[model samples]
Target: MTSPQSVYRAVAREVNRASISAPATRSKTIVKNFRTIIESGGQSNTEHFDHDLANAVTFMKSQRMYKILLERYNPLHDMSAEEKVKATARRVGLDVPLRENSDEGQ
Candidate 1:
């Protein structure tokens, strides 16, 4: 009993609703996976739809993956590589020469 235009409109509305809810669902899943990984000592019994969340976390943290994720997922993510080295050195009480002169004439 609906016109073609009305069917198209309905489909569009449903698509918009799904799009709105999709991100929230994905965010919830990510948080849940992180929680499971933490609670289970690096084990996850649940099957992840796209990727294995626990394994992905392990790979990212391990040398298998690059260090970019640390900046991607933290407040200090904005710190540059040089800044991170400096911060690490300071934290461990190691003296590091300034970047400008540390590698100069060597």
Candidate 2:
């Protein structure tokens, strides 16, 4: 069996290997700018509010795209067919029925 330390190291390595794209970097910058605006109570003009609103929308769209990509490329997709079915059933608050004997269905 793999040790817990090895598993954690592998996860850390994968996380480090995933480099941030330009758009993600921009999103972080936008979030930081918005946070600063909010902290400084600087919503003094309609144009400023509009610009901030646009930034917020852009950030939300990027967040949604990232979520879709993550779901599509999830490692859980590597599960066997039977395991997938069991996972789906469990997700919906149901359980796959257990068989008493492997040859019973035959």
Candidate 3:
């Protein structure tokens, strides 16, 4: 039973965060669409609200995935291949087993 205001605030926060790296047009579009839904009273309709929420969730997921991929593949970082893999694994909630000869524990 989440309140509409709470949901709006939460989505707004995520939209702002995603917009930081998003292209200007794309960010504006997201904001515009969200505002349209809100202003149209879509939240009062369960189906409309669920559909728009799903779209927002999908957009956020893609934004996060893009950021993760960018970080993983960015050559500017000094991360080693194994370190990159370990980082990705950690992000996905899995642990990379330590090698016996690895110096990471030292």
Best candidate, lDDT-wise? 3
| Candidate 3 residue-wise lDDT, 15-103, digit = tens | 87766475554546766666676666653777767666767767886887888788787743668888888878988999998669667
**Model 3 segments beyond 4 Å from truth?**
21-33, 74-106
Identify the leading candidate in terms of TM-score. Answer: 3
lDDT of 2: 0.56
RMSD in order of candidates: 16.2, 16.4, 11.8
Candidate 1 Cα misplacement greater than 4 A, ranges: 1-75, 99-106
* Local error of candidate 2 at residue 56 (angstroms): 0.9
- Cα-based TM-score, every candidate: 0.25, 0.31, 0.44
Clashing pairs in 3: none
Give me the runs in candidate 2 sitting further than 4 Å from their true place: 1-44, 75-106
Q: State the TM-score for model 1.
A: 0.25
Model 2 Cα lDDT, one tens digit per residue, 2-88:
333343344333333343665445334444544555445433664565455555555555666776687797846768999998988
Backbone clashes in model 1, listed as residue pairs: none
